[model samples]
Target chain A: MGPAVKLKDLYFKYSIHTDRSFILQNINIELNRGEYVVIAGRNGSGKSTLLKIIDLIYPPERGDIYIFGNLINEKNIYEARKRIGLVFQNPDTQLITGTVVDELAFGLENAGLSPNKIKSIIEETVEITGIKSLIDRRTDELSGGEKQLVALASVLAMKPDILLLDEPFSMINVIYKERILKIIENFVRGGKTVVLVSHNLETALNEALNNSLMADRCIIMQSGRVEFDGTPASLFERKAEYIESLGLRAPIAVRISSEINKNIDRNFPICSDIKSLVKQLTGLKGKELKK
Target chain B: MKELIKIKDLSYSYNSQNDSRSIYFRNKEKSSVLNNSFALKGINMHIDRGEIVGIIGPSGAGKSTLLQHLNGLIMPQQGSIYIDGKSVIDEWDQKELKKFVGLLFQNPEDQIFEKFVGDEIAFAPLNFGFSIDDVRKSFKDFLEYFGYEYSFKDRLTYKLSGGEKRIVAFMSIIIYDPRVLVLDEPTASLDSENREKLIKLLEDWVSSDRAVVLVSHDMDEILRLCNRVYILNGGRVVSEGPTENLLFDEALLEDNGLDVPEIVRLYLMLKTSGFEKIKKFKTETDFINWIRELKNHA
Candidate 1:
C-alpha cells in the first residue's frame, strides 16, 4: 500500500565548485510497490546517478530516501541494499566469477546461504531465466545480451524485492531483448517493484502493452531534475516539447501520432504498439474493412 | 563501386593456448575449453567503397569480431581478407593496416587515453608521420565540421560527457582519413540531436573513395544509414541484402535476432490483417501522407 521507494528533496553534487559541477537537486519521487516506472533522460542527466543513489552506492548530499517504508541511513543502508537488485548498462561490471553457475552462486554465498540452498536457487534461476545452456559457459564467452541475462540471474538469485535496471537492453539483441522483457514482465506480475532507465522507450512501450501492464509512471529527467512524470500515453502527448526542451528523442510511435494529430482536426488515438497503430489507421472512419 | 574490404570464408577462434601473453606469463593456459570459446565460422561479406555496410546479429554473434577483422585487429586463422584487391595478410603490415583502416572502438574509454581532446585526435595522424601543421589543420577542420567548438580541443577528454567523448573518439580516427572506417555502435550513447548531426556528417564524409562498416544493435540506425546489411548469427552470415528489403522482411529479421522498425512493423501487421491498401507505405512519412489523404477523403 505504501511507496516501495521514496525520495524527498534529494540534492547531490560531486563537488562544491560551480563550473560544470554535477548536481542532482530538489528531487522528490514516490514509487509505489508492484509498479513499473521508467526513468527516461538524456545522457549525464543523472539517470544513472539516481539509480546509484537508490542502490545506496552514493550518499546524497542532502535528502531522505525511504526503501520499503524504512528510512535509509548509514545504519540501514546495507539492509536496504539487500532488498534491491541493481543491474547496470554493462553486465561485466557486476559479474564476479568466471562461469555462469559460479557467478550466480557468488551472491548467495556472500549471503552465507547453505551450498545446497544455493544450488537449488541457481537451478531455479536458470529455469526462470531460460539460460540453462549458459550454465557451463565462461562469463567472458557470453554475448552482451547473454551477459545481461547472467547479470539479472545473479541478482535475482538473491530474491530482492525491488529491481533497478539501468539500460539493461542497450547492448542486447532484439530477440534477447524480448526475452529479457518477458522476464521483467514476470517479475512485475510477481509484484516486485521495477525502475528501468532506458533510451529505447518504444520497446518498453510495446512490452508494456503486450503484457497488459502499462508503466504506472514515466519520469523524464532533465539536468538532474524530474521534468515530467505520468502514464506513458501522457508522456507521448507532450513528447515534442520534451524533445525540444529536454533533448530526449520521442518514440517513433509518439512522433508519428503527434504529426498526424497536428495536421488533422480529428483526434487519432496515440497507439504505442505497431498493431494498435495499424488498427487505428485501417479502422479509420472512411476506411473499408476487408472482412 | 569499388570493393573496399572483402572477406572470404573467414573464421577466427580465440583459444586459451593461442593467448601468447598468458601462455608466456603463466607457462600454461587458463581455461579448459582450449579449442575456441568464441569463434566466427565461415563469415563472408564485401564492403564497397562510398557506402555504409551494417552488421547485425544476436549478442555473441561475433559482430564486433567481424569488424575487428576488417581492420586487422584480429587476424583470421582460417580465411583471407582482401583490401582493395590486395591480400590483407600478405600485403598489409602494421603501419600500412593502421594507415589504411580506421577503427572507432565500441567503448570510447578504451580508445581515448589522451588527457586533452586535441592530443587525442592528433595522435593517430602524427603517429603515421603527418606533419605537425597538417595534423593541426585537419583536427581543426574536423572539429568545425562536427560543430564542435575549437575550444573543445583544450577540454579534458575524461571531463566530456559520454556522447561528447564518443564523438571525439570518432573524430580522432577520422582525422587520419583512412580509406575504410569501422564503427562499433557509434550512436549508442548519443542524444537525438548529436545522433542526427553524426548521421549528417557520415553522409557528407563517406564517399566513393571511402567506405564504412558499422556494427550496431540499433536496427533503426542500420535501416536509415546503411546501404547494405549483413546479418550474422553464430559467427556465420545468415542473411545479406539491400537495407530496405532486408529490414522489410519481418520473419527474416525476427529469425536473425533482429526486429523491423515500428513503421515497417505496422505495415506488415496491416497487410496481414487484410488492409491491402497499406502496401503504398514504406516509411513513417509515407504512412502519414496516406493518413492525410484519408482525412481529405473523409
Candidate 2:
C-alpha cells in the first residue's frame, strides 16, 4: 500500500475572511504504514489543527490529501474517515453515550457489526485499555483521565487502520501513561499507523530516542509550518536550537548527557534513560580514575 | 504562620437522592461503583498562608473533588472545611467563599464563558461590585505584567488556543484578588515558556496573607513550586510532609501511581553512586550547576 496518509501543500484556516493567517500552512507530510510519528510544538503552533485536518474533521482550504493511496474528496471522505480514528484532546467532546460500556459499543454499532461482534470487540478493547472496571460506570462520573482512557478505548473498538491522538497523556497519571504508550506500541507493531500530538516534548522525544518501534519520526510545527521533520535523534542532536526556540526542554537524559559531554570535552552517545546515563557517567569516572 | 485553609475529616459521595438524574443514578446496577464510594474519605489537611501546597494522586483519587470543597462548589457530606477559620458549609455563603478562594478547573473551558478575553477576566470583579474603570486598569496591568500586548485583550476567548484559554482563566481569577488560589493541572496544555512564566508568577503572588493549593500530576512542577505535598489515594491521605521529603520517596510516589521527577531520580542515583555532598535540587539548572561544580573540582 502507499503511505498511510499523504498531505501536499495543505493550508487551513478557521475563517478565510475574518482570520488573517492560516492555522496550518504549506504542510507536506507522508506517513507510512506501521510508522509511529509524534508531532510536537508550542501551544497555538497548529499541531492540533493539523491532526484535525488529517482526521477529515476539517477540510483544508488549499491542499490535496490522500489516505491509503485514495484521494480524499466529499464522496470518499466518509470512507476515508472510517479507516481513521481520532481521539480528541477534550474527552467530553467525543464521548456521547450515557455509560462507558455503551460508549465503547456505540462505534461498533454504527459500523453495523453484529451484537455478538460488538460485545466481543468491547471486551477485547476493555482488556487492552485496562478499563474493564469502568465498563459499568457512567461516562459523566469518570475523572478527566478516566474519560480520556474511555475515549481511546472507544476509538480502538472501531479498529481503525490509523490512530490519531491529541495529547493523550495530558491528564493521565504516569503509570497509566506508560500503559497507554505500550498499547500504542503494540498497535503499530500490528502494522497500524499512529500519529500522536504531544505537549510533553520530553516524554515524546525520549520515546522516539529510546524505542523506534514506539516513535520513528518527530515533526515540530512552528507558526503553522513544519519547521523540523526528522528522526528524534536528529532533532535533539542537530536541531537542539530549534527545540530550545520552541520553549521546550530536551529530554532529561539527552540534556544531561550533552552538559556532561560539554564539560569534559568528550563525545558520548546520547542516552534516553537516567539509568543508562548514570552508567555512562560512572564508566567515565572510572576511566578518569585509572588515568 | 497562620492557617489559611484547613480540612478536618472531610468526606463526600455522589450517591445522593437529588442527583438521581445525574450520572450517579443513570444505572441502578452500577450504583455501587464510584457513587457509593466516598470520593473523599476523612481527609485531614491544612494550608498555611505564604505556602504553596500540592495535592497529587492517581486519577479519581479525589484531588479535584477535594479542591471543589474549598470554593464551595461541592459541599462536604461528612466533615468540615475552614477558610480563614470560617466554615464553608455553615458560616460563609458559597458566593462569599468563592470570592476568597478562586478555583481554576482542570479544563479552562469550564470556567471561561464570556465572548471576549477582556470580558472574561473582568466578569468576576464586575459582579463583585468593582468599578469598570478599576477592572479595565487591572486587566491592562495584568497583560503588561504577563508581557502580553494590550491588543491581546481584544481576542475572542473561544478563538484562543488551549494554552491561551488557560491563561485567560487564570487571569479572570487573579484579577479578583482572592486570598487563596486553587489550581487543577494548571500547566496541562501550556508550553515550557508559558509554564515557566506561570511558575514565576505564582512565586511572586504568594505572600504572608495569600496561599495556593495546587493539584497536578506533573511531579516536576510540584517539586519546584510546592512547600508541602499531600499524596492521596482511594480518597484518603496516604502521605503528607514537606515537598522534598515526600517527593524524594520513590516508593511512596510509586505506590500511589506517581512518577518521581527525573531530576530527583537522577539526584538519588548520583547519591547512591557516592556523590554524598550533592543536595537535592528542584530545577534542572541547579542539577547542571552541581555537575559543573563537580567537573571543576575534578
Candidate 3:
C-alpha cells in the first residue's frame, strides 16, 4: 500500500484579507503505515495548522494531499476524514457532549453504528483509555486533565486508521501521560499511523529513545517550515546548541552525555534516560579506577 | 516576611442545589457520586510577599477551585480567606478583592474577551478608573518591555496564537498592578523561548510587596520559579515545604501524580553512583559547572 499520508507542496493561509503571508508554506511530508511521527516547534509555527490540514478541517491554499493512495478533494473529503481522528489542543474545543458516555458515543452514532455496537465500542475504548470512572460524569465537572483523557477516549473509540493528536499531554499529569503514551504504543502496534504535535520535545524524545515503538520520526518546524526531519536519535546527535537555537530542549540524558563527550573528547553513546546515563558514567569511573 | 494572602480552614463543596439538579437530570447514576464530595477540604495555606508559592497536584485536586477563592470568584462555604490581613468574606466585595488578587485562568480564551490586544490590556486599568492617557502610555511601555512592536496592539485578540493569547491575558492582569498574581498553568502551551520569557517576566514583576501564586503540572517550572510548594491531594495539603526539599522527594512527587524534574533525578542518580561531591542544583548551568569541576579534577 502507498504511504498512509502524503502532502506535496502544501501551502495554507487563514485569510486572504487579513493574512499577509501564508501561515504554512511549501510543506512536503510522507507518513507510512504504523509510523509514529512527532511534529515539534515553537508556538505560531503552524504545527496545529498542519494537523488541521491533514484532518480536512482546513482547506489548503495550494498543493495536493493523498491519504491511503487516494487524492483528497471535496468528493472524498468526508471519506478521508472518517479515516482520520483529530484531538484538538484545547479539550474544550472538541468536547461537545453533556456527559462522557455521550461524548464517546457521538462519533460512533454519527457513523451510523447500532446502539449495541456503540455500547461495545465504548466499553472497549473506556477500558483501553482507562476513563471508565468518568463514563457517567458531567463533562463540565471534569478537571482539565480528565477532560483531556475523555477527549482522547472519544477519539480512540472511533478506531480511525490515522490518529492526529495536538498537544494532548499539555494539561495532563505524569500518570495520565504514561497511560496516553502506552495507548499510542498499542495503537501503532496494530499497524495504524499516529502523528503527535508537542511543544515539549524532551518528553517526546525520552519516550522515543526509551521505547522502540513510540516515535519513529521527528520533524522540527520553525517559522512555518520544516527545519529538520530525521529519527529522534539523529535529532539528538546534532549539537545541543543547534536544538536550543530552534526553541527545543534536548533530553536530559542526551545533554549530559554530550557535555561529557565534549569534555573527555570521546564518543559516548547518547542516552535518553537517567538510568542509562548513570550506567555509562559508572563504567567510566571503573575505567579510571583501573587506569 | 509579610504575608500577602492567608487561608484559614478553607473548605468548598460543589453540592449546590442547581448543580445537584443538573447532575440529576443529566445522569441520575452520577449525581449521587458527585453530590457528596467536597471540591476543597480544610485547606490552610499562605503566600508571602516577594515569593512565588506553587500549588501542584493531579486533576480535580482543587487547584483551580483554590485559585478562584483567592480572588473571591468562589466564596468558601465553611472557612475564611484573608487578603492583606483583611477578611475576604467580611471586609471586601468581589470587585475590590479581584483588583487586589488578579487571576489568569487555565484557558486564555476564558479570561480574554476583548477584540483587540491593546483594548484587552487596557480594559482592567480603565475599569479601575485609570486615565486613558496613562493606560495608553503604559501599554506602549509594556509592548516595548516585551520586545513587541507598537503595531502588535492592533492585532485581533482572536487571531493571536495560544502563546500570544496567554501573554495578552497575563498583561491584562498585571496592567492593573494587582498585589497578588495567580496564574493557572501559565506555561501549559508555551514553547521554550516563550516559557523563558515568562519566567524572566515573573522574576521582574515580583517585588518586596508583590507576590504570585502559581499552579502548574510542570515540575521544572515549579522548582525554578517557586520558593515554596504545597502538594494538594484529594483537596488537602499532603505535603508542603521549601521547593528544594519538597521537589527532591521523588516518592512524594510520584505519589501526588507528578514527575520528578529531570535535574533532580540526575542529581540523585549521580549521588547514588558515588559522585558524593556533586550538590543539588536548580538549573542546567549549575549542573554543567559541577560536571566541569569533576572533569578538571580527573
Model 2 chain B worst lDDT window (10 residues): B16-25
> Which tens-of-lDDT digit does each residue in B1-298 have in candidate 1?
3788889999887663323222111343344345345569988889888889999888878887788887777888988999888887888886788789899877677799999999998999999989999998988887887667899888888766566778899999988889888999888777666677888888788987998889888777887789999989877899999988898888898888786666676667777776666563445667778777766767
**Chain A TM-scores, all candidates?**
0.91, 0.93, 0.94
Q: Supply every candidate's count of residue pairs whose N, Cα or C atoms clash at under 3 angstroms.
A: 1, 0, 0
Worst 10 residues of 1 chain A by lDDT: A282-291
Q: Candidate 1 on A133-233: residue-level lDDT in tens?
A: 66666677666678888998898899988999987776777766777777777778888889998654555565566557678888888888988888887
Model 2 misses residue B38 by how many Å?
Answer: 1.3
Q: Model 2: what TM-score?
A: 0.94
Question: How accurate locally is residue A216 in candidate 3, as Cα lDDT from 0 to 100?
Answer: 90
> Where does model 2 exceed 4 Å of error?
A16-19, A207-214, A259-272, A287-291, B16-36, B145-147, B272-278
Say which docking band candidate 1 falls in. Answer: acceptable
Per-residue CA lDDT of candidate 2, range B1-298, in tens? Answer: 3999989999888663323333322444544474546788999999998999999999889888899889999988899999999899889977889899999999888889989888889899999888999999989998987668998888888888878888899999999999999999999988877888888999999999999999988888999999999999989999999999999999999999997887888888987885677798988788777666655656
Q: What is the TM-score of each candidate against the true structure?
A: 0.89, 0.94, 0.94
CA shift of A278, model 2, Å: 2.0
